[model samples]
Target: MILYIKYMVSLRCKMMVEQELKNIGLHYVVVELGSVEILEDITLEQREALKRNLLKSGLELLDDKRSILIEKIKNVIVEMIHYQDELPKTNYSDYIAEKLGYDYTYISNIFSEVKGINIQQFIIHHKIEKVKELLLYGDLNLTEISYKLHYSSVAHLSNQFKKVTGLTPTFYKKLRRKRDDNLENI
Candidate 1:
């Protein structure tokens, strides 16, 4: 059986869910962001206990269809922007609509209604975050970062980065370098 989880977005959350399953004496084949696959069927007692345990960690076991769909949307964006090595070449709306098998308009409306921000804005937020991470790592230049994230150009990436963070990517890199150097001196 496959179970959906709410607020299980990060690697740490996946670990926590795995531990909870072990504690509950349930064996899961896989634990991933927003969902888990169990090898054996679960009992009501196990499900209730797992729900309560997950709640203690600020996570939730989802039950409703709308909630499940919302989590799926978030998971897709998170996986695409953060985990994938390269952003998809296709437009995000097309990618998302294809992935979820729902009309773009339908899910976009639901996501905006529940998340209070449109999905495109959410994608931009995550892409900017990825750019920051790459800048700090010192592995990719602005142009390369922009290409990896599928921005039109380095200038476009810098503009969006500045608008979201109030700091140019160059400035952000400098600040991180200074901070790291200061830590090393102490």
Candidate 2:
């Protein structure tokens, strides 16, 4: 039996879900970001118990089709940004549409209506977050970050980063370093 879960975006959320499943005496064959496949059919009682347990952790056992599709879209984007080393070579709209098996326009409209953000804006938000992570870790230069994130140029990445955060990537990195240094003195 396959179950869709909402708000299961992070690795911690996955672990919480796995623990909840074990506590409920269910064994899962697969436990990915947004969905789980149980080894055996679950009972109504088990479902209710699982739902209640997941709710306590701010996760929902999804049933609505539109909600499930929305979660799937979010899961796809999250997995691409955080888990994958590289993004799809194709344009994001094509990649998302192909993965979801839906028209890009339809998906975009639905996501905007539900989340109040366009898909492009959503992708930019996540990409900027990834940039911050790389900067914090001091692993990649601006040019490399631009290339890894598929930006047109370092200037473009800088402009977008500044616009989103009101701080240049370089300044952000320095600020984080300063804060870490101050903490070390304590």
Candidate 3:
């Protein structure tokens, strides 16, 4: 049996889900970012119990098809932006469509409807967050960070960073503060 989960966004989240499955006496064949596959079938009662337990830990058991698709989209974006070391050369729309095996138009429309923001905005938000992280680490200059993030130029990166964050990249980096949003909330 396969189970989709919402808000299972981090390695710690994966561990928590695995622990919960064990606590519930369920044998899972695999547990990934936002879903799990169990060895045996689960009854509705077991599903409900699992849902409650997961809720206690700030996770959600997804049952609806649309919601499951949304979660899959979130997982793909999160993995691409935060977990992967490098961004792909291709456009994000094409990458997401190919990865999810869905039409780009369909995915875009659904994402906008459900998320109240377009996928482009989501990508930009994540990119800015990534910039903040790199800045905080203090390991790279603006030019280096722009190159690493595939930005066209340092000027462009600085402009966008200031537009979204209301501060120049240099000033923002100097603050040495963390400003990030929850993946689930994104």
lDDT of 2 by residue, 46-165 (tens): 999999999999999998989999999998998888789998899999999999999999999999999999989989999999999988885789999999999999999999999999
| Candidate 1: C-alpha RMSD after superposition | 1.4
**Cα-based lDDT for every prediction:** 0.93, 0.94, 0.89
Q: RMSD of each candidate?
A: 1.4, 1.2, 5.6
The local lDDT score (0 to 100) that residue 110 gets in candidate 1 is 96
Better model by lDDT: candidate 1 vs candidate 3: 1
Full ranking by TM-score: 2, 1, 3
Per-residue lDDT value at 120 in model 1 = 87
- In Å, residue 106's CA in model 2 sits off its true spot by 1.3
Model 3 ranges off by over 4 Å? 177-186
Off by over 4 Å in 1: none
**Residue 7 displacement in candidate 2 (angstroms):** 1.5
Q: TM-score of the candidate numbered 2?
A: 0.95
lDDT of 3 by residue, 74-155 (tens): 8888899889988888989999999999999998899899999999888888899999888887488889889988899999
Q: Which pairs, if any, clash in model 2?
A: none
lDDT of 1 by residue, 1-186 (tens): 999999998999999999999999989999988999999999999999999999999999999988999999999999999888777888999999999999999999999999899998998998899999899885889988988888889999999999999999999999999999999999
